[model samples]
Target chain A: MMRLLKIVLLVCLFFGCDKKAERPSAFLQTQQIKLAPPRVLTTSTIIDSSIVLSADFKMEDVKLRYTFDGTDPTENALSYKNPIQITEAGTYSFKAFHPEWTPSETTTVKIYQKGMDTIAIQLRTKASIKYPGMGAKGLVDHKKASLSFTDAEWIGFDTIAKARIDFGKKVHLEKITMAYLVDTGSWIFPPENVIVYLNKTDSIRVQIPNLKSDTLALADVEIPIEKTVQYLTIHVQNLKELPEWHPGKGLKAWLFMDEWIFN
Target chain B: MSYNRRSFLKQSSLATLGLLSGPFYASAFSSNNNKDVIIGHNSHRYKVDLGWGMLDPSKTPVNDCHEMVQDSKGRIILLTNHIKNNVIVYDKSGKLLETWGTEYPGAHGLTLVKENGTDFLLISDFERNQIIKTTIEGRPVLTMDYPKETGLYTTKNSFRPTETAVSSNGDIYVADGYGEQHIIHYDGKGQLLNVFGGRGEGEEQFLNAHGICFDNRDVHNPSLLITARELNQLKRFTLDGKFIETINVPGALICRPVIHKSEIYFAVLRSKNSSDFDSGFVLIMNEKNEVVSCPGATAPAYQKGELQELYQTVRLFQHPHDVCIDDDENMYVAQWNSGQTYPIKLTRV
Candidate 1:
């Protein structure tokens, strides 16, 4: 009876005292990693006489540094006082650094001037209601999506979109880049196959895959046309059916696109 | 009832490892300010109090302060997902009264219902896929597993209950907000009465129907107000599941509908866009459903009966889930996925 009573008392004591169950250590694990590179938002269109660019960071105390030379921007580089103005054709870089946070990587932007003039812009299929452009005039609006998927600046297609950018004046163009948004959960996927037209004769069809990422991604893909094109047109074919793992599987996917950048 | 702490802990640990597995970070803030920030607009302005419920997290940790409710005894009851102490009861002055509960790993919703002058809690566990009814002292009187009889859920995981609303006559309406977006209505006996509202963008359909509650402002003519967070609208439905009208509060991802006096309030989970993380505010709507004030966001504006795009102005909260208004009209906010922080108090000025 005495031994049983002691065991019972011990069990009661054990039950009475409860220790705190901290969050899993793996969740609280901290790492010293470099911060994300500073974002650069250039003028609406880079094909201008002079290009203007801006750089900013979330932290108020973080100082921005930049360099127009080929050297990487560092703490010792010229401190950013105002928006950068580039007149000559060259690439410029910028970076941000703070004492506590990890220093951001060097971000570079190139300046270019295009001589071709677009005479007409028409859509093969009109964009949907929520993401329609300014009635095709938005194609040459000189505004691009600034890392925002739902920025109201891009035009989205329900399944597919086809537009022709009639550059009346022919110029030497080797590559064409298109800005697209990838957020699979929102039923927004990238173009599956892109067919580009050069001078109404030569055409190139390039297949693009769905970007496998959970967070929002502002991605760009370039197709090497490798020719001095006259009339340029683009055909964005959205994903016919989403993958089985996706919640909206078998449903038609959407494609969001901003200005079709010309290079 | 004797406290079988060992058995509770043993079962809680085992169930937590399986049902509530996730990585969570707990934030630590230094005690400093008395009242440096004041939020809200017009007559609803309030002085902020960050130290309202600052407890030793080592002993009482919270994983998503999902909801808050004030009982008749004037004790502030907070429901969190942390199984170690799922329910933390505190006085209005932020004094710790007692802590109990270890079964709710996905403890998301909390509704304090008064029955025969006695108070009970309805906690919706999204992870375990169950809704629990317990006494004031943490005694489980009713355990409602997935409503298999409703015919809405074919599999158990498809019924993720996020919030519940108990009618005056004891009818429990569980919003499967995180599930297939159906509001399962049940009687006091836990028998299914009806099921309505599914996944669609129409007036009757819901996209992330996160919250549901009976708006008894008229007392005689009460209706259900449901939240379509993605659509940024609060939908009013007849008690029998018919869509009546819609209240559009653009750019505000409003959560559950909370009523105190004549005005209705809810924590805007996010604003401007659904993908914008940690951007949240609080909105107060008058009896006409016109937003009177928006706490932490731009002032409520309406031009030609269309609300302008509203976004956060003062960064006061991150992903606020629900708001509880005390008898003194003081506001207490609970947050979700906010680094394991406690509820913030806003004393009305």
Candidate 2:
């Protein structure tokens, strides 16, 4: 009887002790957990004079804070009460925080300066019917598409995308910047090469770099033209065939263009 | 000798105290003291048990644990695309009961049906382009191929069915989600009766008809809830395939609808868009189709009767494809493209 009682006691003792410690709940582990980043909503990241930047988070009692000096936002940062008016070209980061919750990841938005205005634009190639975007004017509409191609801001092309832009008057520009999406998973690739003609004479060819990752990324192809011009004609060569490393190797690659900035 | 006996009694009492003081025993008996992570919002919060369904990968490997269902015997059944062990059966406590099926390579959907007395399972295999009805013990009973009589399908490949819903009268409704986006209706005898909802932008059509379920909440007015995943909308249709209304859940790529009691739950496959990979959560709605809670994501909010765009607020889930609720009001979430992991169990808090 004593032996049996001892065995029961041992078993009870075995079941009593917890191998794991009584750690704090993960939800309560503020130092180790970070909330998802807040969304930075704006008409366009590519701005001319000024742009309205709005930060939003779904959770209540959460304050959205931001910084424009390329630093992570903290509780002491400027709390976002309304949409911020950005008049300069720089990087802006936003973070969401609550007293009872961990701070959110930082959301970064890059602003590019483009002051030249296009009075008229013409599409020389047909855009894909599925992603026609806002038409020819969308390229110069000062509106930029997100990294997502389905946002309907990007105009896709299976064939070569050619366009001509008229500034209406001569404007000195340092360079021409064109932005495109490179989402290999969606079969969207950067153009093979972009040829730009200034005033139908001075020309330069910008070759896109070969991407090594399959992640979604944006490419800004810049053509250096340090002269004044009124009319700009450009031809963006589509990737004729997907690279051998891609799953759709031998198939045609799609070219997605969202905005063109003349600076 | 009297002193020794008294000392013995004292030791026994101390042992008992020690047992009661154990943190493990305390937590096991009183859930109030459980230190597990608690998530969700409103009256639908849950305690996450991330290791509830975890198993030895070498023994019972799973890839893309697609869907799950609870049997009449209170057993949880999980379906995966991994052909090695396509079906895994587990008890309510997450104990391994059995594993079966090596033929369903693309087993994407699992539905449990109780007929007369016995429980049966409906498995939708998109890669095989067929739907197989099997016994709970893994015996194949009925096999259905593409609805060739519908004339909408050019070939068998064009009938990639993703989900199936059975009415009380034994009628089967198949959602050809990845195919031509049509809903094929058939009688109990496997004969095609009617077809509706093809690929279109109209209210009667679907972009990605990923899931379907019989909503008998209104007994006299039974309807079907279908998922238009790409559009982030849950469409309701009458029994005969007439558009009733739409419940919009914008920004969530919902997989299927699982109705339990007075609430509807969905495994949001991804958030924002399909390309935003590894962003998923579990969404729950009340009887009025209002989102009450979203575990692993933002709290549900409404502006002018329209649900605000929802996204993941935490990385708790990655591509949650289906949710199965048991009799205990607990949830089991199966995932797709999540590193060959097992289902996650969420116990009601």
TM-score, every prediction: 0.63, 0.82
Query: Model 1 over residues A12-89: C-alpha lDDT tens digits?
Result: 233421234222121101111233346567784345667777875534356889888767887899998677776765
Off by over 4 Å in 1: A1-260, B1-35, B274-276
What does candidate 2's lDDT look like per residue over B1-349, in tens digits? 0111001111122122122223333333223333344679998888776556667777998978899999999999999988889999999988999999999987998998889989999999999999999999999999999888888877899988899999999999999988899999999778998899999778999988999999988889989999999889999999999999988998998999999998899999878632335668899999999999998788998998889889887545667899999999999999876666678789888
Per-residue CA lDDT of candidate 1, range B1-349, in tens? 1111111111121111111111111111111111134567888987666557867778988877889999999899999989999999999987899999998888888998999999999999988899999999999999888888876678889988889998889999988888889988899878889889998899998988888887889898899999988789899998888999998988898889998889999998876442334568899998888898887666787899998766654335667899999999999999876656678788887
Candidate 2 yields a Cα-based lDDT of: 0.80
DockQ of each: 0.05, 0.09
lDDT of 2 by residue, A91-142 (tens): 7999887653456657888788864664688999999998899888888777
What docking tier does model 2 reach?
A: incorrect
